[model samples]
Every structure is written in structure tokens, then in C-alpha cells.
Target: MQSTYTEGLNPEQKKAVLHHDGPLLILAGAGSGKTRVLTHRIAHLVEEKGVAPWQILAITFTNKAAKEMRDRLERMVGARVHDMWVSTFHASCVRMLRSHIEKLGMGYHSNFVIFDSADQQTVVKSCVKELRLSDANFPPRGVLSVISNAKNEMLTSDRFQSLNAADYRLSKIADIYTRYQRILVQSNALDFDDILMLTVQLFEKHPDVLTSYQDKFRYILVDEYQDTNNVQYLLVSQLAKRYRNICVVGDDDQSIYKFRGADIRNILDFEKDFKDAVVIKLEENYRSTQHILEAANQVIKNNRGRKGKTLFTQKTSENKVTLLAAGDEHEEARMVAEHILWLKSTTDYAFKDFTILYRTNAQSRVFEDVFLRQAVPYRIYGGLRFYERKEIKDIMAYLRLV
Candidate 1:
């Protein structure tokens, strides 16, 4: 007597979707249909478990992810999905702040602008010039990164200044940080990081507001749990404190976001963070051959101080992993081009089926040179990320006004 929502889910996935009582951590391996599990869990909560749609919250890091989840949930649960809140932390914070903004004691309205990096730099530059500091040594870009890191750590100017009172160089950056924040407030605005920081502050300073949301979102699902930082962890902890029905899905082996200050500890010690937590591992991978999964597991096992798990696959294929050695990058690029050309010539696979990944943008140049010389029909798959491009930032800043 399997419900339609639970159909086709593996035992591990079914366990995750049905365990709706307490904190649950699903170590979902790649290609394990975690999205299917997530959406179905939401559908189960609404349709089977007698949970209201508005009482459940699904959080992801990107709007694209939020939109995709909403689209899939709509298909699963029909029009009733509109009551649930599916959005990024920033977008969710903006919504919360829109209603309870006056609680901050700051003179900001719901229509306050959200500053982009470009807009932040403009404020930083103004502050540096006003302070008569040399932009060559203490550039706005560097200062902006400092400010961002501080905000990500839930640090205020006063906290940061107290921590680095003796360092003269930091003193200057602290001044800039304070001045930049003042400018944002004066302009009735918040930067991207400010959104989360302010939300946590709102909860901490105003327990009534936190209690309201804690009561509202009885069930919470966080995707990409490994990529959560301190502020995000705080915000989630506060919201999930009351009912404690929080489900986080992530793989510690896939935690490659240390550069962005993502705390791998959040996923590594999920049980300690939440009481009576149930950990589920979705080890069955539907994509790739068993050989590939074994190879990937072998490579990732060398990482120290990580939760141990191996991915398995039922899909058997003739594909084998190969390693190629080349004297130079040109040779490497040329070898890849030859392989792709051979793949195209013999197999039914098209150019779309083949992919070449590099460590950085510079590495793509050698491949581009090879593709041009070989006249290989190919397309590079990346450029500056969406928020990194100037045009996109400009448009985003303008949209923040609305």
C-alpha cells in the first residue's frame, strides 16, 4: 500500500521522507535523487502527515534551486504548494524583515534597498576618500571583502573594533566598515550579508519575533547543508528550535566551499547540534557506473577528519575510468580534443554529451587553442558567475528598490 508520493523512492529515501518527527540529517550521495526525496517529503507532510503547507519551510541557497523545488512541488501536491515558503535564506530574510523591520530599532522601511557589490564599493570608496586614505594600499575591494567576512561571522563594527584595537591597519578598515554600514543605513539599505545578519539580530534581540516564526515553521528542510555558514546556521537553529522537525541534506565529501567560509562542521556534527537527530544515508546512486563511484570514493577517502561513507550504484556499464599523462597543457588539451572527436565519430554521443572541466578560467585557454586548431565543434560552459558580472549586479541593485 505505497502512496503515490512515496512510489519509486528507495528504502533510504522513503525513510527520510517518512521520518517527520525530529531532526533528520540525510547524507544524500550524488545522483541519489535527493531533490525527489525533498519534494516528496514536503508532499507527504501536507497530504499524508496532516501538516499545513504554511507551517513547512524549504530553504536552498539559490533562487534557481528555490524555483526548481517550487515547480516540482507544485506538480506533486498541486496548487496547495503556494502556501509553503520555498526560497533562499536571503530572500526569506527579506520577507521576514519586510514585516518586522521596525523591531530592529533602525530607521528602515520595508522598501529599503538591498545593495550589490558594486553599490557597496561605491559606499566604501566614498568613506575611504572622506578619511583621506590611499586607495592603492587599502582598496575598497579588499575592504569590502573584510566587511563581508565580518558580517558572515555575525560580527558588528564594535565587536570587530574591540577585537583588533591595537592593529593600526585594521583600525582603518574598521573605520571604513563602520562608515560603510552607516551609509547603507542612511540610504535605507542592506547588503546581501546584511540581510541574514539583520535577521539573526532581529531574532536574538526580539525573542517574541523568533518565537512567532519558531511556531510558524514547524518543519524545516535545508538543502546543501554543508554550504551553510555561521549566520545561516544561527538563523536555522533559531527557527527550528520549537518543533525541532528540521531535515538537512548534504554530503561532507562534497564540502568544497571552505573558501567561501562554509562550515563543514555543521554537517559533520549534525547530531550534536540538534537533539535526538536521526541520520540517514542515501548511498544508492542511479547515475554513473559502479567503477566511477568506486574511483570517486577512493579519491575522496584521502580527506582527513570527515564522516566516512561510500557511494554504490546498481547501474552496470562498460565504461572505465582512464588517466592520461601529457608533457604540457597543450598536449593535454590536444589529447582531450582527440578523445572528444573520436567519441563523436564512433558513438551516437554528440558534443553535448562530452564535457571538459578545468581548475580555473586560465586553464580553458589551452583547450580553446586546441579546439580552434582542431576545428572541434565545442562550447565553453562558463564565464563570470551571474553576480560577478557588472551588468547583472547593476540590474539587481535597481531591482532591490522595489
Candidate 2:
């Protein structure tokens, strides 16, 4: 009922939000009110387009993003989102598998345990030890990584064996893979990857289940589409095949998950996957100033094979961005410390207002050492994080065990 949903949007953004039917892609540029458009699009579907809340499914990559989407929708449509599904892919898979994994005819029914990395490592180590393989020869973590890659490719033990049945190392890995899966089944457990792979398995092997889901969720929205892996891409392809009411929002330039095996081509070749797709570009930057947008656009435009888009901001500022060149990393750290002190003394900015960005985890040590030497009160923000730490996972495992 609120026309304000489309009030702040530009022409392209309004087009994306109002396009209710068919496959749609929103190439939301960085700082271009990406999340706002997504939420408004969902709100538009429910409030203005007469779509039932339960028929919509919004999938995000991370729990934090999923939570944000849920919170935003709750504010927009109140309690209706409780019936609709707005959660991470893993969480949605877990929810589906909980109800229908019993359909797989595997012994893994409801109440089957979900194994964390440490628990999965223990199971792999046991299998390695039973096979009399030395840790140096076949490390558990490395073997687990291979299995994970295979699962992400949607390969089963039989399929993997068919591909690598001859090589000795792969033969051993195949044996380990089968053995590890057997151990998981025996323990009534599935690893994190198995959650998604098993959901796909249930869908493929059981047509009724897939049909029910396709019927239930008529509209699907995927945030951060560029960061999806092969298995996730396949899952979305299958789910969205029947309805084809999929709206994916992502920027190819923001596809930085390549190191984590994210398929950047998923966003790059999106139109090819969904034929006759509607593509909308949101180039008006809502967060960044004009100078910042210009600097970022200059750097990202050099990359080839990305969709051509330019970001512009109406916000004008006299402040110009400075690029500092230091002789060495130590001097760079010192300069950063000096700058932070200067900002604190002159400007109204506090230490918390500053965020030190680094390219890699190794770079964090330089900041830590510098902050300590400079007697600056600063806390490192990124790491395994709160819920991902070993201790917290161990506690959850204990509770689940009970």
C-alpha cells in the first residue's frame, strides 16, 4: 500500500523492483543501495503485486545477510515473513533435508547429526588410521578438501571413482571417500557439504519432493549470486526451472570469493542460463561520495569480461581520496598510525570510526604490531568470528550429542 517503496529508487532500480514475473537480474553496483532494492522488490511483490508471502523464497549466502533480509521484510510486511522462507542456502537445505531426507531411502532420517569440520576431521582421521595410511602421505584435512570439492561438483563416490579409478593416489582417495561416507552414515551424521548435496539428491531421486517444493515456492530471490558454487548454482537452476520467477542481485566486480571456489561465471553468464532474462543495472551509488566512486570505478573497469557499468553519486564533497605510497610495510604501518592519531586529534572521528582494511590475514599482524607499539586502543575485527570458533562449535556439538 506504500508508494514510498518506489520513492527513493532511480529508474533502473524501480524497473527491477516492479518487474514481478520472469527471470530478472539486477547488476547492483557497489554502494548502489543493493539491499534496499532487493528488500523493496520483495515488498513490492507482497504489498503491491498481490503475491502471497509463503510463495516467495529469498536465499542469501550468509546467515548475517539472511537475518538482515528477514528483519527488513518483517518491518515491511510484519508477521507474514514467518511463513515465507528467507534464509541462507545452507539453512534452507538443512530445513528441507530435515523433512525429506527420509525420502532418500538412506538410513539418514530426521534427527541425524550434522557434523562440523572438527568432527568431520575426526571421522576422516579414523578412516585414515584404519586404512593404515600415514598422515604425511594422506592428510585428513587435504583428503577432506578433495571430498568437499567433489561434493561441490555434485559427484558421488561412484561418479568420482569412474573419473579417477586408475590413479593410485586417487584410488586411495576414493576408498577414503567411500569409507568416510560410510562412517558418517553409521554415526547417523552428515557433514556440511552433505547437507546441500543430499538435498539435491533427494530432489533428483524423488520427483514428488522436487515438485512439491517447486509448487510451494513460486518466487525465488538469491542475493550475492556471484558467490555461489557449482552445486548451489545447480540447485538454484533446478528449483527455478519450473517457476522461472527468479530475481538474482549481484555484481561481478564484487565476486571476490574465487579463492573459495565461487563461480564468477555464474553472474557473468547469467542471461545464458535463463533465456530471455531481464537485466537491470543500478549504477547510482547511494553510499559512496563522487570521488570514492570514481576511484573504485577506475580500478574495476580494467577487469575484462564484466558487464559494462558506471557508478555515479549525486553527493558532492570537497574531500579527495589520498593514495599513500610507503617505502616498506613497516613505514606504511607507521604512516597509518600517524594518520589515525591526526584524525583523532583534529576531526570529530573516534578510533571506532576507523576501519583498517587488509588484503590477507598475514597483513593483520603488521597492524597488530603497529597498534601495540603506537599504544593505540584498537581491536582486530575479522577472524574465525564468534560462532565459527572451535570452542563454540565444540559446545554446540556437545549439546547436539545430548
Q: Local distance difference test, per candidate?
A: 0.90, 0.89
**What is the model-wide C-alpha lDDT for candidate 2?**
0.89
lDDT tens readout by residue for model 1, 41-132: 99988998899999989999899999999999999888988999999999999999999887798888888988898898999999999999
Q: How close is each model in CA RMSD to the real structure?
A: 6.3, 6.2
Error of 2 at 47 (Å): 2.2
Steric clash count of candidate 2: 0
| Candidate 1 residue spans exceeding 4 A from truth | 345-349, 384-402
What is the C-alpha lDDT profile of model 2 across 122-234, one tens digit per residue?
Answer: 98898889899888989988999899989999998888888998898988888899999999998899998999899888899998899999998899999999899998998
